[model samples]
Target: MMLDDLSARPASVGLVAGWSFPATVFDPLVRQLPGDEVVAFDWSTFSSDWLGRGQEERAVPGLGPAVWVGWSLGGSLLLEAVRRGRIRPARLVLIQATPRFLAEDGWPGVSLGDWQGLRRAAGRQPVAAAAAFRRRFDLPNEPAPSAQLAATEGLDWLARLDLRSQLVSIEVPVDIWLAPDDPLVPVDWPKHLELPAHVHVHRFEQGGHAEWLDHAASLARSLVRPLADDPGARSAR
Candidate 1:
């Protein structure tokens, strides 16, 4: 199946941002989402309040039946919503995201001390922290004014949130895109992920934390096809 086939199946598609990032971060990728209408979920619109408090105020709005794409923190939050029964998407495209962001029980992830440092920087010096965060991902764009707040709150969420136990409850088929070269998300993180056989995992050899944006065209092209169309085509380096 191709983009044309996907466009005929879903009338609209959704794009979710990660952490401090906004929907604008996915603008380049949205342009390549076949011919379907794309809905960019801007966290800013949700509220100026902290993410933990604001995120609970409303459910993720429905976008009919479509493949929802999320990256990093955005992907985690999407799964959180799913676990809470807020939304049910037809399919999920998760890029550089994990069930648990913090390292635990031999799983590769950010260390507790490192996560603490990030949390403090985000809370006390948000602007600087946001800049540093973007620099880590090699992102060239400037974030929105409220991004600092969101980033801080996101780090707070990262420190305490865990989703490993919720994986079994996620019914939607997922396509996980992992960038082995990612500095933040460990290269061998997938080895720790215990997913159902129906879930497809793809590991890219050359990309970073922001691979979803850096290789938007190729990612969109690959994902526009049926989920199982080419399972192992891009799984290995």
Candidate 2:
């Protein structure tokens, strides 16, 4: 799916990071999107303090009618927010994310035992496990301490939360980025989902789960270009 229409950019772009990845990691991507208002929903902070604290806790200031770009667990969280009417975005950009984290409905996902084992390891050796997990994704930066704060709960949420139906119900334009070789979330997962007609998908031949880190420039372009065709964005401009 190509976003060929180019014009004005969105009024705001919300960058949502994956679990354990801080908003700062997206600085490079942000730099690529100049002249557009941008806000980031820090995964570390959200996980640590706002997991199940209720609607008020999930509120992000100045975050409406923008293109919401979410990666991994961040994408699921964003969908949940939309499901609960917490935020309404003009468009959605999901990277290496799936509606369900745990295997269900014949879809590929992490098994409960493996998910629990990782959580246990994180519990036993928080820092080490954190570093190791990042490295596994080819991300060298150290995750924020807040990420580790909700490690156990975060894993539980991943293991149980399912948003397949929510994804299909969304009507706004959407883009999904995938790495075919992703070990966690399968590349074909999105194809199985009965998403809306506006949903477009792009798969990278080579990249780790954190594809944004390596394809920052390409992703930045893909994300910003679509805004030009967004009716709401054109009206905002």
Candidate 3:
């Protein structure tokens, strides 16, 4: 497992929670991590209540500018924080993230139909909406999400949002690990993502939206290696 491997490494980490995903989903990886090696972060437990008053910089104090491993929605929030100059991670690994989720005339993120359908489905029946999302986004090999809880989380996201325009301001070392087969946050989104000069990207052949969950340790290693090995080198961005 990724944790077993990272446990031996002498570095700090901050794992961001995926969209509509509970912290419990990460227990497998978190439980095995070196107690001092990584820390858990998310808007649910940390910033859910105190949010909007501004950003929370001390999300993980002892982690010492952690290497952020963000999946799905977490990736956007991580980028938002970085753009707002809120949380500063040592490095960022975006696992199947899209800078702009909704589609526009010129932009081809996700179609308005997709967003409308999601909203309508959620309005009609929360359980069905959650199931639809899970079936569409989470890979077949990934964990099954709780419909009720997931729907609630999704509602939260719909309420407070929009970090797309901030991409130009992100200054940290970012490596986006995309999934060629992702059915939800399509890979095309990243290829066209007009990010800051410091951002970077990597692609996966088969993993879906929850790509990192299927292989978090490998992803962690792949993403962190560059940052750990070349802190000052600063890749082509």
Best by lDDT: 2
TM-scores of all predicted structures: 0.81, 0.81, 0.75
Model 1 misplacement above 4 A: 1-11, 34-36, 43-65, 143-149, 227-233
Residue-level lDDT of model 3, residues 1-237, one tens digit each, is 444554346367667666556655665556545667777665354345224454454545443446766666677767766665566677777767777666666655666677677777776776567667777664432345455445555444633455656665566677877766677677766546577767775665564666556555455455335544532222222
For each candidate, C-alpha RMSD in Å? 3.9, 6.1, 4.7
C-alpha lDDT values of all predictions:
0.67, 0.68, 0.60
Better of 1 and 3 by lDDT: 1
* Order by TM-score, highest first: 1, 2, 3
lDDT (C-alpha) at residue 164 in model 3: 58
Measured by TM-score, how close is model 1 to the native structure?
A: 0.81
Clashes of each: 0, 0, 1
Which residue runs of candidate 2 sit more than 4 Å off their true CA positions? 1-7, 47-65, 142-150, 227-237
The candidate with the higher TM-score, 2 or 3, is 2
In candidate 1, what are the lDDT values of residues 1-237, reduced to their tens digit? Answer: 234545433446667777777777887877766545677775443223213454443444463436667778777777776776555777788888887888877888888888887778777777677777777768655455354445566676565668877775567887888886787777676666567766777876676787666667666666555534544336742
lDDT: worst 10-residue window of model 2: 228-237
Sort every candidate by lDDT, greatest first.
Answer: 2, 1, 3
Residue pair clashes in candidate 1: none
Please state the error at residue 217 of candidate 2 in Å. Answer: 1.4
